[model samples]
Structures are given as structure tokens and as C-alpha cells.
Target: MKCSAGRKVFKDFLKCEYSEENILFWLACEDLKRESNPEVVEEKARLIYEDFISILSPKEVSLDSRVREIINNKMVEPTSHTFDEAQLQIYTLMHRDSYPRFVNSQMYRKLAQLPVPNRKGSIA
Candidate 1:
């Protein structure tokens, strides 16, 4: 909680893909690992955290109860694909804008589009 609380106000910057709450939860883990053990963090712990996060695919993220209900769920317009087409479609609305602004805007939901949850703690 040290790292999370330390950057709590700056938490707003860490969330671009989803609700700030849940994204903060995941990003906080990075801070946890780094601050917990800075020496080995870059080698062992970071890779482990990333691999674990990768297991949570976009489809899984889209299906998250919080994501569907809170983020303004609209009909997914059924697609034959196993992946979530709805989330991607909504995310693409600002695909052409500047990287930080468009990606970080509240208008966009990061949980769906970002390929990975990669908020490496700035503890260094």
C-alpha cells in the first residue's frame, strides 16, 4: 500500500484503459514488487507479474462484471469471433489521436484496447 498511497493522486495518470479503481489495483502490484525488492524486481518479479497479467486477455477483461456494468454496457452486436469485438470497436473511435491524450482520455476505456497492462512502477 505504500507505493499505491504514495502515488494515489497521480493514479489518474496510470489509468487509460479502464476504470481507475481496477487499473490502480493492477498497477499497484507493480509498485509493490519494485518497492518490495528493487534489486530483483526487473528480472524475476516483473516477468512473473507480466506473464500473470497476460493470462487475462481482452475478452476476459470485457467480460469482467465491473467492466460491463459500470463502463456503460451496450449490446455487443454479436460477432462470430470468440474475442470481444464490441470493446475493440469502441476503443477504435479515437485510434487516430495523439498517443498520450487519446490513450489516456476518460473518453476511452483502456481495459479493452491496450495489448497488456504494463504500468511499470516509477520507483526507480
Candidate 2:
């Protein structure tokens, strides 16, 4: 399946598993990394950390102690790459763990059978 199609499937799977925050955090990090303004980068990085890395956050992602420590240190002066390690970890976790299950899910099977759309938006 295409990466974008797989991403949509995986996101639905994450929602079913009540762990959509993982993908959300990864997407946020991607957006932060594309920022041209240093101030915006710092602000977005801190927000992402607070939302996904802080232990107190309800949406906190599971991360190893080493990565957690790295993030904590970087939070003092947050940068766009501050969450790179953590984001990679989450992405790997989802790809290795959730992705297989998603590919085999009944939902995916049903979606795969649907007719593709044409440029005019009609099913082909």
C-alpha cells in the first residue's frame, strides 16, 4: 500500500487502540522541523514536548529513559530537533508493532477492496 494510505489506516488503528497521540506527536515534530523562524521552532518544540514527553501529560508516549533524559536536557533550550530521537522511537514502535496489525485488520481489507477514484472524483 502507498505510504499515505498506510498512514491513514494506521491512524485509524491508533484511534481504535486509543493511542492516536503517538502519530499526532510525530506529525507535530515534522511540522516543527519545517519551521523557518527560530522562535516558532522553540515554541512548537516546547508544546510538543509538553504534550507528548512530559510525564504528567495524559498523552505522554512511551519512551526509554535515555531518550527521555535527552529530551529533558534539550527542553531547557528547545530546538526543532529536540524531539527527533523520541519521534523516531515512536515512529519505529508504530511501524514495527501497530502497522502489522493494521495491515491485517478487517478494516484495511475492506478499504483495499474499494474502487479507486478517477481525477474527476468518480470511482474507477
Candidate 2, overall lDDT? 0.85
For residues 49-68, could you state the per-residue lDDT of candidate 1 as single tens digits? 23322345332222344444
Give stretches of model 1 more than 4 Å off.
1-124
Model 2: lDDT of residue 101:
76
Cα displacement (angstroms), candidate 1, residue 57, comes to 4.6
The per-model lDDT (C-alpha) reads 0.35, 0.85
Clashing pairs in 1: 17-109, 17-110, 17-111, 18-110
Where does model 2 exceed 4 Å of error?
Answer: 1-5, 114-124
Instruction: Give Cα distance to truth, residue 81, candidate 1, Å.
Output: 37
Query: For each predicted model, how many residue pairs clash, with residues at least 3 apart or on different chains?
Result: 4, 0
| Best-matching candidate per lDDT | 2
Per-model TM-score, in order, reads 0.20, 0.84
Model 2: colliding residue pairs? none
